[model samples]
Target: MPEYRAPLADFEFLLHDWLNVSEHYAQIGKDDIDADLVNEIITQGARFAESEVAPINQIGDQQGCTLKDGKVTTAEGFPQAYQSYIENGWNAMLGSEEYGGQELPYSVAIPVHEMLVSANVSWRLVCGLTESAVLALEKHGSDELKETYLPNLISGEWTGTMNLTEPQAGSDLSLLTSKAEANDDGSYKISGTKIFISGGDHEWTDNIIHLVLARLPDAPAGVKGISLFLVPKMLPDANGEFTIENDLSVGSIEHKMGLHGCPTCVMNFDGAKGWLIGAPHSGLACMFTMMNDARFQVGLQGTGIAEASYQGALTYAKERLQSRAPQGVQQPDEKADAIIHLPDVRRMLLTQKALTEGSRALGLLYAKQVDIVRFGTEEEQAKAESIVAYLTPITKSFFTDMGQEVSQHGVQIFGGHGYIQEWGMEQLIRDSRITQLYEGTNGIQALDLISRKLVRDGGRMLQNTAALFSDMINAIQNEADKNMALEIQQQWLAGSESLMSGDAFDTASRAYDYMQFCAYSLLAICWLSMKDRAAQTGNDQLASSKAKTCDFYIKRLYPRALMHKAALGDSGEDLAALSLEDF
Candidate 1:
């Protein structure tokens, strides 16, 4: 079985040295969020993940989830591990103080989340969705709804899920046929069959809260008519006891490519009693709150998986012996040299390291923006909101794409052994694949980046992005680092201009490339920040490692941005010219 060790030192460097989150927390009046408290939380979270959750990974993957008589049973050790997770207060890290939550900043929760996902992403899915649900209910739920649901959800006594997809509706939620009829006591009758619902039904919790999106009886057309509903698997009585069963059932759980431990169910809601969340006909808007949170967590999922894959590959490379090194047989006592001595192997390992660490930095930066949006002043909130909006798609799409690529590299580095199941390299590839497809597919995320975030405001978000790059560039004293940052920013600016000037067809065709370009550029900014911060702190070992990684990223990986930029100019005429008959 593969092993996972939390990158505690990296977390410390990013939180304290690079981002200076402690000062930011103090500025936001969160004096309780010092380095010591943050360290304690991360330490305990890491211990729990490494010890409890990770042991069940292979067991879950092998046994998978069993659905018998509509109730889903998780793999061995899952329930016990989850019980420990809840007992440790891990689920309440980001919840509100008004409920039974710790009320920590989002940034503070991010490292803990990364560790859990890295430990075992399959199990982490349950916790991730519940956190998103807690955020959505806290932001948009009515006073009564909050009082009823927030406590248990935050306390991890019950879990939550987001139900948006149906047979006819996937990305185009407007086609959803799920219907909601008004009921007499201000509740609505929700009837819909939702597919691909993670944590839809699990034995770990007594009840599950589902936030379903459906249209009202007399409603407008398309997404405009949809409204959010709070539907629970078991309804609570006036005394807050879940004794009454609701009209919802788990029709079946999907036998998926990966994440077998987490049950992805086909849920059927037959006139389930539910209450309105936000305003009528504002379902999409309300759900966006949860969707945005889920999207960011998915990005963390990618980073976590990449870290796991890299660790496996690096361990195998050092232990596995191959042919002698090109220069000479350094290990004269042994029959052959380790693969880590090979240049090609070094390239793969460094690529994994550079991208994984870069993704971590970028994600943490975004998490800080989320923290500011929640706790900062009006001016800070406005700026952070724009940054968050602009970076959401990039973070989600880019990080996952990197995760898939890095995992593939891990498999390749292991040679034939990577294809085998026991080493766990193949599982990483299978697990990381879905991150690109779900939470709005990477292609959809790219289009969203181009259409909504970039083009909608006449490049205003790009300008905000450029200002961020400029700040880091100015702070860097090294000429090479400064020049590399400038190059990435310049290319990104030119690509944004190309996207803005293109017609609809051209923009749609090149949006994916543009999003990739933006991701590389943003990662460059992150690398530069890490390099500069490491040097400033007099941490020679970290500074040297970061500098070498930054150099590798610039010399090798950064050129991909240029290629994506060139691809942007293609107009995709050849793609459109191909007829359906060509197939």
Candidate 2:
């Protein structure tokens, strides 16, 4: 197994340069962030994840979770670790300042949170889901709703879950049968069965807040009928206190292939007390509020898994003895030269570095877009919102999909030792698999990108994207970054033109596939820009790594996006060409 090291330099470069996150704070009319503060926070964040959580990752996998007749007892040390995570401010990084959050930009939260995911995904999911819940409510919930739950959620005194799936309603929300009946007192009683709800029923908090999808008795049928509700494990009374245990209980905790530390519960609401979140029969829209965040969170799972595997690979490459270097006369004094000298091994390690950090740079940028939308001026806010909507699916799907690929590579690179539990490499592979399945499958993401998003409003989003690319490329050309920026600009144009001209079906997948391409592209640009910015008169290690990664990206991964583009088309008729009868 390889050893794990924080990609601090990569993180620092993205945070300070590509995103220019501090500018986000200024746009929001605040001055709470700067380079020094961002660095300190990230350093502390990495230290906490490495020291407190990383050690328990494999332990959690080996111990898994114990399901009693009802209660789910997580692996030992998990409870304490959860407390430690709370005691620090890690849980509240993105919460509103009014609710005791640092109110820092998502750019800061993005990388720091990725460190946790990379360090211990199974462990961090519980906390990460809670954070997602807080952000969603802050965005859509009423002031009163925010007052009641936001503080506890931010502080991690309580955790949250999103319940949208049932035995029959995984992908098709139209199949959901969860029932919510309205009360005269402006509330509702939610009674339904929800299965495969991650963090649905954890005992890590004083209470669990569930954002469930259900329907009213008089609601319209199908997707339009679905609505959102806030159902709690323990219903709070008028005084805003959870004095009584609500009827929302776990039917069972699902046994799964990975993420064993985060309890996957089959939650049952037997006439549980609930409150409508946004609008009646508009729950799906409101539920998507959190889903958007969760999707990106899932993307980070890919980046996180890649980073963990990369760390192990880095450790293995430097320490593991292998055949002599192909250069013919290197390390004559040792039993064998380190594998890091070999181009293929270095390629695998660099592959992880390039993809994982590239994913980080984009995720951080998207997150900063979220903060900008929330706090920027009117025009800035509108622009941020549009970009966020445009990129959400891509960010979510691409990173997770690619992360799984990278993890498989990471395991293979370690050879036989990678397969065993002791190495943690195989676990990374298994664990990375679920990110693609959750938060909507990557296939769904591709469809969302290619079909829904691209065609919506007659490709207005596509137009906006073209404009951004043009502006960026023009600037790059002016500054001698013409080749790199032009490459991305060309892809953007080709994607948009193909989609609009009825060749979109053959346009490959611009959303997810193009995202992976642009993920590296944007990061390379951001990293290069940041390196240049950080050293007006001196060199920066972060920038140096950035340069290497950018080169690797442009020279290798960035161009590969063409293959996926080559794969897209107008219909699945070709795929349906195969017949079950023929088989």
* Displacement of the residue 459 alpha carbon in candidate 2, Å: 2.8
The lDDT, on a scale of 0 to 1, for candidate 1 is 0.91
Could you give candidate 1's per-residue lDDT for residues 476-567 as a string of tens digits?
A: 77787788778777878887876777677777888899998889878887898788779888889999999899889988998888788888
Candidate 1 accuracy as TM-score: 0.98
Residue pairs in candidate 1 whose N, alpha carbon or C atoms collide under 3 angstroms: none
lDDT of 2 at 520: 47
> Residue 176 lDDT in model 2?
91
TM-score of each: 0.98, 0.93
